[model samples]
Target: MLALVSAPTNLGLRPPQPGSVPGASKAPEALREAGLFELLRVGGAREAGAIVPGRYVDDDATRPPGRVRNESALVAHALRLAGRVGTILDAGDAPVVVGGDCSVLVGIGVALARRGGTGLIHLDGHTDFRHPGNSGACASVAGEDLAVAVGLHWPAIADIGGLGPYFAPGRTAHLGHRDDDERATEARDLLGAVVSAREARQTASATTAARIHAVAGTGYWLQLDVDILDPDVMPAVDSPDPGGLDTGELGALLRELAPRAIGASITVFDPDLDPDGRCARALVDLLAAPLTTLGSALR
Candidate 1:
C-alpha cells in the first residue's frame, strides 16, 4: 500500500520577490483540491497526514555566508519530513510524498539513509547541481538538492543528522536533465547512470528502468520534479525549461519506475502558477495511474 505524505514546504526556494513567499508551499492542498487524494484512495492509498513547515523568511539579505535561503527553517522541515517518512516506512507502506519544492529530496535522502544503501532515481528537468563549488548563486537549496543529497554541498545541508552523502554517486541515477544542462557532462561522469531527456524519449521505458536498476545499489527512491514534463505541458513549475518529457512519455516511464521504488517524492508543482487549476488537474491525471501502483514490485 502507498501512504500519502504531504510535506508542504517552500523553504528552499528564493521568493518570487523580496517579501513574497514561494507559491509552491500550497502544492499539497492544491493537488488535494484537484482530487488527487480521492483517486489515490480509490487505488488503496491511505493518507499519512502532513508535516507543517516553519514560516518562510526571506533571509537573503541577512543570510550567513555559507548558508542558503531559509537555511535553519529548511533543515528543520527536512528533519520533520524525514521522521514522518521513516514512520510510514516502518509501518510497511511506501510513502508517496507531495512536496513544495525540489529540496524535499533532502528529507527523503535522510529517511532512506537510515535504511542503509538505497539508490536514487532523480527525474528532473535540470540537474539541480549548483553548489558553492560550482556557482556563486547558491541561495536556493531547491536548485541544489541533487548536489546536497550526494554530499556535494556545505556540511550544514548535506550532513543533516550527520548522515552526509545520503546516496552514493555510484548508486544514484539522474534522468530527464536537458542535453544542454551545464552539469550534464559532469553528472554523467559522477553518477552511476545518466540519461538525458532526449535519450529517454528514444529509449524504451523498460530499457531506461534497466539502466537505473543496473546502478550499484539496493532498493531505490524515485524523485519526481514535475518540471521533468515539457514546459508546454507543465509550465507551472518554478523553472520551466524548453525540452522535457511529454505527459504520455513521463507516464510510461513512471509506470515502469514507480513499482520498483521503495518510495517516491513528487515535487515542484506551483499551484500559484496554475490559478485555473488546469495544470493541477493535468498533473493529478498524469500521476494517478503510475503512483497508484508505486512500490508494487516490492509487494
Candidate 2:
C-alpha cells in the first residue's frame, strides 16, 4: 500500500494572492482525482492564518494569515507528517507526500534518513543552498532549504523532523537546474553533481533516469519542485525559470526510476500562482503514472 500524505499548510512562506490562485484552492482535489490518495489516509497540521510570512518576496496584506503563523508550526507539522509516513514505510507502505512548499522536503528527508541512508534526487531550477551568513543574489529561507537539509545552515532548520544531516553529499543529485544565483556556489560545494537543464533536455529521459539511478544507488527519495518546468509550462511558481523538462520527459523519468528506488515523494509550491490549474493537473498526471506503478508493485 502507498500512503498519500498531505501537508497543504503553506507555513514557511505565502506567495502573493494565494487564495486567488486557481490551482492553489484545488490541490487536494487534484491529488484525489489522480488517485494518489487512494491507498493511504490524509493528514496535516492545523491551518494557520491565510497570510503567512513571505520567504522570498515582500508580504501582501491581501493574503490570509495561514501564510505565516510560526516557523515552529511548519516544522511541527512536517515532523508529525514524516513520522506518520515513516511508520507506514516501515510497515511496507510506499509514501507519497503532497506539499505546501519545498520545505516539506525537510520532513520527508528526515524520515527517509532515519530508516537508513537515503539518496536524494532533487529536481528544481535552483540549488536552494544559501547559508545564514552568506549573502548573494537570492537570499531567503526557501532558497536555503537544500542547504539546511544537509546540515549546511544549522539552527535555522535543524530541529525539523528531529533528523540532522538528512543525506550525504555524495548520495544527492540535482536535476533540471537552469538558474544560478548566490546559492549555486554553496550547492556546488555540497552536492555530488548538479545536472544542468541543458543536459537534461538534450539527454533522453531513459538516459537521465539511468544517471540518477547510478548516482543515487539504493534507497532514494525523489523531491520535485514544479518550478523546474519552463515558465510557459508552469508559470504558477514563485520563481519560474525558462527551459525545463517537458511533462512527458519527466513522466518517463519518474516511471523508469520509481520501481528502482526505495521510496519517493513530491512537493508543489505556489500553485496559487497558476490561475488556470493547467500546470497542477499536468504535474498530477505525470506523478500519478509512476505512483500507480509503485503502488501496484508494492501490492
Task: For model 1, give the 10-residue run with minimal summed lDDT.
Answer: 210-219
Q: What is candidate 2's lDDT per residue for 72-94, written digit by digit as tens? A: 55566657766776777777766
Taking every candidate in turn, the Cα RMSD to the unseen true structure, in Å, is 1.1, 6.0
Per-residue lDDT tens digits of candidate 1, residues 1-299? 88999989999888988889899989999999999999999989999999888999988778888899888888888988889989999999999999989888888889888877588999999898898888988889888999999999999999888898999999999999888899888788898998999999999998888888899343589999999999999999998998899999999899988888888999999999998999999998999999987888778
What lDDT would candidate 1 get against the real structure? 0.90
What is the Cα-based TM-score of model 2? 0.79
- TM-score of each candidate? 0.98, 0.79
Please report, in order, the local distance difference test score of every candidate based on alpha carbons.
0.90, 0.62
Candidate with best TM-score: 1
Measured by C-alpha RMSD in angstroms, how accurate is candidate 2? Answer: 6.0
